[model samples]
Target: MKTITKYIKISALALVATFGSCSKILEEQPRSIYEPGFFETERGIMGGLTSMYAHLRWIYGQAYWYNTLLTGTDEVTYAQQADQNFLVMDLSGRALMNAENSRADAIWGICFSNINTANGIIEFAQQVDGVTEAHIGEARFFRAFDYFLLAQTFGGVPLDLGAGELTFNTSTTRSSVRNTVPEVYTKAIFPDLLHAAEHLPETGRVVGGVTKTLARLYLAKAYLTYGWWLENPNNIPTYPAADRIDPDGHDAQWYFQQAYNVAVQGIENPGPFRLQQTYYDVNLATNDRNNELLLYADHTETSEFYNGGSLTWGNGGAPDNFAGWMLTWNYTEIRSSSSSSAWSAVSSVQREAAQALGRPWVRMAPTIGALSNTFADKTNDSRYDGTFTTVYRGNWNKAGIQGPLYNANYLPVNPGDAILTFLNEEPTQAISYGAPFNSNVGAGVLPGRADFVISPSGVSRRIYPGLWKLGPYRTDSGSGLGEPNAGSTRPFTAAKFSELYLVAAEAAVKGASTRAGFTARDLVNVIRARAGVWRWDNNGNTERIEDNSAAMIASTPAEITIEYILAERSREYFGEGYRWHDLVRTQKWTQLASSYTICGPNIGDRTPIVFQRNIENFHYLRPIPLGQLDAMEGDRGIYQNPGYD
Candidate 1:
């Protein structure tokens, strides 16, 4: 169901507060009350489940979460913002992330809070007669999901398991249950997911609910990520204590095989899932319940869509606007003199194409590596056009002019002069740019140039691709329902079923698990075909994806290696916020991103000045949040992840 009906009042338990209040009294409850009595009945169990699901909205809805994931990866960099908090060291490659980093703290807090919430629900569900395996299974799935994020992002964290490990009261002093990476995998993430997979409904459900298929998807991904750690124990600084290591053989290959098996099972199942015709279709609000989505953090504009979809305060599970929407919008927009006219630029498009023309926060921009290298197949790939924008029409309204153009300068603003014009086709050096540029294109003249060179430097006329994926799609300020600024309220995707294809392809290449009896080529080709990359297929291995590093040529399925797979993943999922984890898990962050110049004058001409970041081996994990360190009563402060202050 898109909206889970509430049957019982949600508990604001003491896990959040050291001696937090227990569930409310049943008789006094508003329609329903929260308490042990509620847990004992089916209605109460379902309501509690609804509350647990609400935790997801909290975890994924924050803007900072997206910022943490996207910045400093191989794909993105920040725009110059005088008020920006991130440093150059962060977004370039080496994220000088410290325990005090607010983003880290937010991530830690959100995950653990939800983790404890899930634990409480699971604990109560076990003793209830009416709460069947599904109720417990749902709770178990979340326990593992939150832990999986914790394990991947922070290495090891306090293993709460409803243990009051994170309680915030004064009298209830307890130590952190933080354990090692492998322990977290075995005791926390993997087992919970396994239980969830075994008990969750095998039949289809909406993206908002946990299903057997979704459980398996996460299990496979967790195993896939853990497999990387198993192979190179030394590479990760958060290695488990000597005792935590298996004495008998659990190797990377074992994890891979496990992941492969689960993935294959999910794929082979007669589930309601298949690739959508276009990448855009996967995320449109209209097709939200489509089969291709395995799981997602749910959000809705109306209460009808979700039980409390619009109830912000009383209902714990009301959907929220992602905090990162503003950040993502700012970073990915084109910098233009006429940028204020963005709305005017879109005045002619269909109403659905409500053009807000983002505020040029330019807090992040596509790395030159992302823009030029990833989409090497300029001719066939549909993703290129779908993901980015090239042409920028003028918004004469904001500019207070017919069109944005000038001869040499505005009032002859030399040196600082800028021009705004469209190029019907790319220009050769031979084309002349007449002054006071007009739409008239002379035979050998560039269409929109007005003495393009004499008045402006190349910078003035340059318009980079706006990351259209996050661009506002609706602008009906007509509703008075937070319209206009309401664009950010659009739901952001946290995961996609399409990633399963990439997972299977990568697994096949590593020989860690069954190739699903399909070659990496076949799996990748399915996505590529959907992406409109009409290249070689499983039929004959006719052509291989281009990496842009090499000349255009055909490579066979045999050439489908991890490097190509990673490159392909970049093409398919760059702005969706997977780059850092993608590179880190694949052990490619340092090799691919460390040397990137995030800010300052173009060391080689691509990077625009702002903040910068780099990657180091220790960077694989973000520092444990400082608040967590301060709260720990023991010398447990010694447990801080290395390389952070």
Candidate 2:
């Protein structure tokens, strides 16, 4: 894209200090103009490296780019109040995804800009005084980091933006050429990460900076993804029409074994990073930036300047952490009675800056399969409770509505009482529909219950569970509802330590030889064992301490297939922007996510409708952005992916 040419001329810095670290390492002033000779100094190299972390906010937690990761997958679909930005991505024959409207353009622009800044640092930092190889390794990790994302999304990307191969470009050029998939992995991604792993320190320089463990995680992941591309088990198509042959003489089995070896190395020598004691503690907003998280796109509730967005109101754009608002239905519409005798309704549930309730956009909703089939073991597994806000309690007293309000079956509800609940299973008792309460949404009433409820089969687009992990949390919200319109201040998690175990397991499933204690089932059970422990019951709003690890391990099948690993990955990392990449890497998008069931996008609609996606073999690779194709001096047909052209 032309943004690469423009970014080289200007330097932008949005340095943030959310975690406790050395102040000099995390703070820097912004620069307007970046000359070609500026990189020869130590200050210029530090500023450029900090901007690489800041640019991740442009893609990770932004709402539109979040839609590109999830909407077509089996995890989520478009909701009642969805706009065209979310609808076209469902891929259910409503509208086709073309180069213009696909939000993958956000990744194209942001990654290329960061890659150019990294190239400048690596080329000029060696001549500067008192610069170590560890400082240069940080830049190398970010360069490979962005290229791996680009290679996975758009199959073959341009290694040379404007200048020669892997060089920093100073002048503008219009001509571009696409590199092959093997060239990107072997020539750019693998080499940079290998240098980073060898030269980096064990611990990070800053609070969340790059280190040897972080480099090994990405290197192992790239090796595993490249091995699947070489195998081509499903015969999915690639862009630029290159044959699936490694430039090096290694086969797919060699890459898989390398992936397993590196992942095991990272797991053996984890520096200050380990799995959390329970699944609930891993995602709790108060426990953010914990030891389990390796990398994140951080934001602060303390400062609007360092947070890169407003602290009061977010406009749902880049540098704003508003991905949580997309799946949140409007819980403010739920009502209770002012008088128990008549039908005088009072709005019971108000939006608050709590972990369970946040501002609602109603743009995306979870499917029936995600609720019922994926999380079937709700009794023993705590991930379903930790991942979703199933119970929405009343806060009408905090919103200045006193007196005990009446709810379903004419029962009383106070401030902390349950207002609405997304039930775990379909109740055997008869459900009473429409009454003194406003059943405008698809909620029904049970006998002598104070809360309105909707079973798993009754979940609709207008009313469903909110994503509890990504919801809003702030210490400034005292006894009142604090800034509900503001973007979330929590750091969006990018990579974690627990993924090292899953990566080794996936590689072992692909014909890599296993060690004694690190078999495929043994590695997966490490994650499943943690899912059994519970410190808090999220839906019940009570403290529940239990250990069901033996039951969880007993339920595992004797033989673990790739399909079983995919299911466990979903239960562990659902709604964290990992679904599409997982499906694409295994070439199981068409086999697993071809059809899904969800209710229609209306208030009172509850009938499960099965929708079919027109997924073709040519759809394995996403099209190049229209802006990139428009700026280059070549034939557009040759520049784009096959089916989109």
Candidate 3:
């Protein structure tokens, strides 16, 4: 049974004051209106459980920060300038330092707050009468989920299982990095998920319990990450040596097989979700039955509250458009030009002139440049259509122009150029050119010009070529709901089912094959078929079949598995937040950081850059905030992880 918890009406000042005092102060303050005593009844238990779900708002809202920080910059690049914060991080090459304080604080506080609430629920739910085993199972599932996130980011965090037996003490020493990787998995995460699976109903099922399918999903992820860490401990720096339990213990493959088993169980369950026939078919605008592969999702449509819809466009703000909607300067255009004789002449002149002036046009690496060529191919590949919007000629009613116009460079005047024109009241000439042109040009007819010559076709003629699918069309004046420019309203694009197929494929290769489940090749084939690619034998390997089948078929599964996972992730989830973490987890940071280059105004050729992972200071996790450290006392060594000064 679903229940709702109305938010408590406490003033912001009161909340600040209450938490500001030490644990002793907390005791003196008036107790919360709704305490453990109030939640001893069935209705109260239900309300408490529902409040746990409320915490999900914070999690999903915080996703933008994670997605942007992870994807933008050398770690990842925005296709356009709509969301420039992440792009600026890449451009500036700064560490994940205290400079971005609010986001850091939000992440830290929200996770802990959720954990605290879950603790209260878990502790009190046990004492409530008429509360079935299912309530206990839900509380455990949420507790484990919260811990899973904490474990992922801040390794070996203090495990607070319940409200303290003693009074809340602000000066307590933090627990030692207690659980080993396997130990944490076995002790905290796995037990809760297993219990949840036992209590949850079968597929086509929803109750007060987390369904069996959801438990299997969580377990599958745990097993996969565990296997990856055991095999490649060097990649995950946050928990060094945690993966190495013993020199001669069970191999990485064993853990992977376990993950595979759980994934198979989830796949075999008769869930309502499945992959959409095409990538374009998944939309919030359509009232479709959510999909077969969605293990769990917040069904509430609070897009406004959490700003999920705003992410459809670039980062949300004025003066800057959304990141996903802006077009980037196509390096392919520059590369192709560099290779041509005519372009060679122009480039040679530009190069010599720049060299004389101690500047040069930035050039991307040959390998990175190949991505554009690959994407530009107008094939029946599903990704091309799914990922990029097509360019076409159209009138810009605002500008009173009729021709193709690239969205990236859509401003009326080049902000950097130093020229201006003014209207003149002469019959033959409508406007006159002016000198000392430091001001912006106003819209008017130019003298001796018949009409504006808009380019029919060129790189500059397209807007946000690859990242333009954030939402549907809207007027410039922000009138309609779900329109691109509507005030405080935006379109929606949820990442859905097709990704599960990729997950299943990767899981299958790593040991997830069960009798009832699809093989890696089978999963890939199904996805490729949706992309309009015809299937061939290709030796029954997903990676090989998808990535130039002839060449990859000869490679071993281990070699093929990594390659397939990376390529599939890049093609399927490029603009999303997965790439940076993917690179970090696989230990490819140093290579990619050193190899890639950026091009834009103010950034020239030979300008070296490095991602946070490449630097030594970033090896250990980022420091807990200074304020948090100050609140604790004695044995700082126990509180902090290794590698800090």
Q: Pick by lDDT: which candidate is best?
A: 2
Q: Give candidate 3's TM-score.
A: 0.63
Say which prediction, candidate 2 or candidate 3, comes out ahead on lDDT.
2
Query: After superposing candidate 2, which stretches have Cα over 4 Å from the reference?
Result: 1-3, 10-25
How far off is model 2, as Cα RMSD?
A: 1.8
- lDDT of each prediction vs. the true structure? 0.53, 0.86, 0.40
Error of 2 at 299 (Å): 0.4
| Tens-digit lDDT track of model 3 for 613-635 | 33342432434434444444455
Candidate numbers sorted by TM-score from highest down: 2, 1, 3
- Model 1 C-alpha lDDT versus the unseen true structure: 0.53
Superposed by TM-score, candidate 2 places the C-alpha of residue 287 at a distance from the truth, in angstroms, of 0.4
Of candidate 1, the 10-residue stretch with the lowest lDDT total is: 1-10
Which lDDT tens digits does candidate 1 get at residues 103-132? 655556555555554655666776766667
**Candidate 3, RMSD to the unseen true structure:** 13.3
